[model samples]
Target: MKALKIAKSPDDAIKELLSSLFENQKIKGVFSLFYDQDYFYGLVTDKELFNKLTPTAPVMPANGGKMLSRLTMIEPPAVPIAVVLKPCELRAFYELSKLEQANLENLIFISFVCAGVLSLKEIKNNIEEKVANANQKQGLRECCQLCENFVPENADLILPLIDGDNKTTIFIKTERGEELLQGIENNLVEEDFDSAKLSSIKEERSRYREKTWQNLKTENLGIPGLIDIFGRCINCHACGRACPICYCNLCYFDSADNDSGPRVYEAELERRGALRAPSGTIFYHIGRMIHVSLSCVGCGMCSDVCPVSIPVGTIFTRVAEETQRLFNYVPGRNLEEKIPISTFEIKEFEELGEA
Candidate 1:
């Protein structure tokens, strides 16, 4: 309902806002991306480092939700800290909060109207060009191109990534956001949130998602397809490490219980002509899907971290879509929307013969 008029660039406007917050002592720290040799996330406390804050960076090295969980899983900060994240990261945070892996106390979430992001590899080459081409089909991460939930549902603040707009418009979505803007010299201009543009983007992404999903399904539906896709897996478990939703402290797949001894491998090799070394590759993927598909926010971190170029994020997003649809649930749509697994219904899944 309110927009912050930018005197210079959008980044500068955000920096100015952050500077004010720090100088005013409104926040004790900030959790956001900073530019160094590369863009990285840090809990910034020094006022001098505010210039390095690229809260709108087009590269996501890691999911903000996971990083935030590492900071606050055990205990929340004593003072308020501002957290700047992409819409999907914010949604992922909400999911983690529900799973009791993140504490939501004394934190301000700032999200944005994402224009998608470039792949980590492509970003190192011709960064500006890739950012300019973010709205296009090329150079973006697959999940971003097909992401429908770009508009964050319930963030404290929202920065709209509108092209060719000189003034950086910051929308205050909650009282916390309004309070953060106080004592700052900015006019509160009335403007409608651009629902029309958002709807158009959503439609475009949905079309792309369906088209890509169709192609992916054709290649990855049956057992043979699954093997073809997952056969290259080196059993690195990097996907799970990068995933914000895969927050189990001691993953069963990584624990001693899942380990295969030499005798077991020898017996399996004797029964069959050969065995897939470091076996259960496909089982690991399926197990992860069953565990986190309902809460997955499709942030694309898993695919980004995959050394084998497996489209892990895309597969999980596809699975999450179907599972969430069946349960009539949307993760991180709001704080109050109950996760389907945490609740039970007598009539639920009755059509599937559950009674």
Candidate 2:
């Protein structure tokens, strides 16, 4: 692994580095974030256009991985493409790749050591303020605060954002990244990465995350706690719409069969004295959990989109962590790690065998 440095601002240096991918005859397309009306991910061939990218924006309105998954699913690049994604976004995209929802061939992923992301509402749709806030390592959403994977894995390149805004370290992790470095070596200064500083931050974040997990026990959040957490749910399904792991073309909850005839409501009314007008809130949520618990990357999109102000992302992350623990797996950490429910093995986990 080699590190490179530049004497330009984070945005400017990143623009120069990413733009060089286009000039290199090997790369054909670029995928990155841009703020037009709102933040958007686009596939642009023009390297110069990357100058406008805000890849490290503090708040994410939606998961960019879902968009990249759709794009790669529909059509792979005829030539190699360089794509820049946040660590969480890259992790979600990696999860989708395992499910075959996304193809990874001809794609070079660029990721960075993430600080954390905040609530979009807290930033109030202010783009300038959002960019400025990216430097702060605290005041993040619940899910982000608990996230331990600050540095991305399996990325071709990892950009380390330092304490200051102007200077940063670009670490080349893969052969694909080395190729890009060779192209821009003249412009880059060789620098040793500040491992001590990075380690200190990781230790601090991990300690904070451990404390949060302890506080969120079921004894502290039982039946009434669940109701209080999701009581205001309008059953709008907006959370599912925003989730990157929910790659289903049509959700089971959205099926016509789920909206049964009058007799179904009558049966429900008979069973429960009276039902909530928009019933099945808990059912819908659990069903989603059954589907995505093993693959959830904890990107916090569900909580971000919830109109009722529910801590959907935090709840899902807690459940996902437990579910993943049962199988001794971490989603997106390993490309070869099979999703538990998708495969069958006879000898595995016999201790838990009901027989």
Candidate 3:
């Protein structure tokens, strides 16, 4: 991989690079996290606003994939724009693109070896401390703590966080990335990505994932356990709202057809003798599981936004692991990879019929 070593802090180095890109008219705008009183994903068009860009912030209030979908769903940009996304968020964007929920035309993707993100629950407390401990996995979101896909795929440019010399290492992975850095004065250095470090981290997270998922499985075993875990749901749908993969304009649960009249509630109440006030709560969870399990990137946005702290992201991710394995598929792994459900195979599932 081609490398560009910038002798500045990661945030500062990235800011400078993006500023140069914008000033040189290489990219019309940059999509990254911006710092106001809080960090949020936004587009920075004016060079003056470039300093406010916080591309490596440890907190993720929402997945960037949903924002990109909104930006390019109607039509792709006329000019090339650079989008800086975390590994998981970029994966989610790729999944959305495959679903035709996003257009990838005229876009430049810059990703990073993610150190995971702190939960939104911890966003209000000790921002500096959280960022400092981001790589160590303390106080990070559960899905992030166990995430194995921290390495980005299909990224044009990647920022390496493994080096500790206080230099930002930019690895060029594509011809587009090479062209983007062509005009800039760069030091050509032979650099090797620390694959051993990456493997160690992956192994540690794999062990953690097995242990965590085992506990979750034991806790939520049968239908009653599922009901117990999800019983506190107020049907607020905050999880669905925050989920990057749940991109439907109108969710089935929120549709007018789902609204039960008084008589229907009365009939159900009479039949069961009691009913959960917000009915179909379990059904909604199951429905979402069926819909998004294949494409869930385990970004943890769903669980992060859950008001009742239902661990929605964890549950969905666990289910997704099974579904994706069954289909021998990996979501967001490639732009050209077809979604399993969208395709038809005549001989598929023949074993079920034989039985």
Candidate 4:
């Protein structure tokens, strides 16, 4: 597929393109994000809302994948729709589809050459300045800073964000994309591709990720470190709510059994020195790890919505890497690769847990 280069600011281009999509009846709907004066919001198709879309507006405190699931999980749209999302969001949504929590039948995936997320300050004040300035580089969120997968791999359409490369052409990656974008050839250009720029960027990102992993492993990982970071949790379960993959309609942690009565509290105080008021702090955290570590995509929604500001996403991601490595699986890399839980081979692992 031929890739498109985005030379000028993308907001103008998006405005024109999306307006056309709405008018052409090519798509029944559109799903993406928009930024106002102080906040960013996930929005569905609205021709009334132009030049306000910001698909790459950094600082995503929540996962857009969760939003997509709400739109398409139970019932896919009757007609095709275009949805713009980040790479990580796409990955998480893919996992949800595997669990039968979402369907992708009538949706078009649109993504850009991602450079990772930005800080909230950058999103609010520096967005236009940073986009306009060729010399400036936006600082990434912690999850984004350590991320190895920065580009959207299998989207139907992709736009380039690499600096100084904007002859801005959109690459069609699927027959569906071709159908939707058919004959609207006014703004797009296609040509011979060079993989050097993207490769170099990936290499640098990989190196940084390796270094960050080493540092995270050496200094701030393991059980004790996790407790230290998460000790402030008030048992709010905000992290679970924010996570797209933690899709249990009735989570065990928040059930009636977890509510502590006077007798339950007295038993707890008898066993331990002091009972943490809203009990099961460690239980909740451990349960989360065991339940979703293999599927965790580390979108930073957990950290973003945490009331106490724990780095929940990074902590889960670090542990998840270990667990996923043990199983030799990546959460959303391929739809065909069966999850470790479902794929059993009795012939394998003669002494699986032996020391």
Q: Count the backbone clashes (under 3 Å) in each candidate.
A: 0, 0, 0, 4
Clashing pairs in 2: none
Q: TM-scores of all models?
A: 0.93, 0.92, 0.95, 0.86
Better of 1 and 4 by TM-score: 1
How would you encode candidate 1's per-residue C-alpha lDDT over 107-210 as one tens digit per residue? 99888888777888778777656665665667889999999989987898887767355668778888888887787746787777888877888899999999
TM-score-based ranking, best first?
3, 1, 2, 4
Q: Model 3 residue 44 lDDT?
A: 75
Best by lDDT: 3
Q: Rate the local accuracy (lDDT) of all candidates.
A: 0.86, 0.79, 0.87, 0.74
Predicted candidate 3 versus true structure: per-residue lDDT over 97-162, tens digit per residue: 998899999999999988788888886786666666665757888988889999987899888777
Task: Report the lDDT tens digits of candidate 2 across residue range 139-250.
Answer: 4777787777777887997788874757867777888778766755755555565667778777877787678678767448766777777778999999999999998888
The local lDDT score (0 to 100) that residue 35 gets in candidate 2 is 69
Q: What C-alpha lDDT, on a 0 to 100 scale, does residue 267 get in candidate 3?
A: 99
> Model 2 Cα RMSD, Å?
2.3
Candidates arranged by lDDT, highest first: 3, 1, 2, 4
What is candidate 3's local distance difference test score?
A: 0.87
Clashes of 2: 0
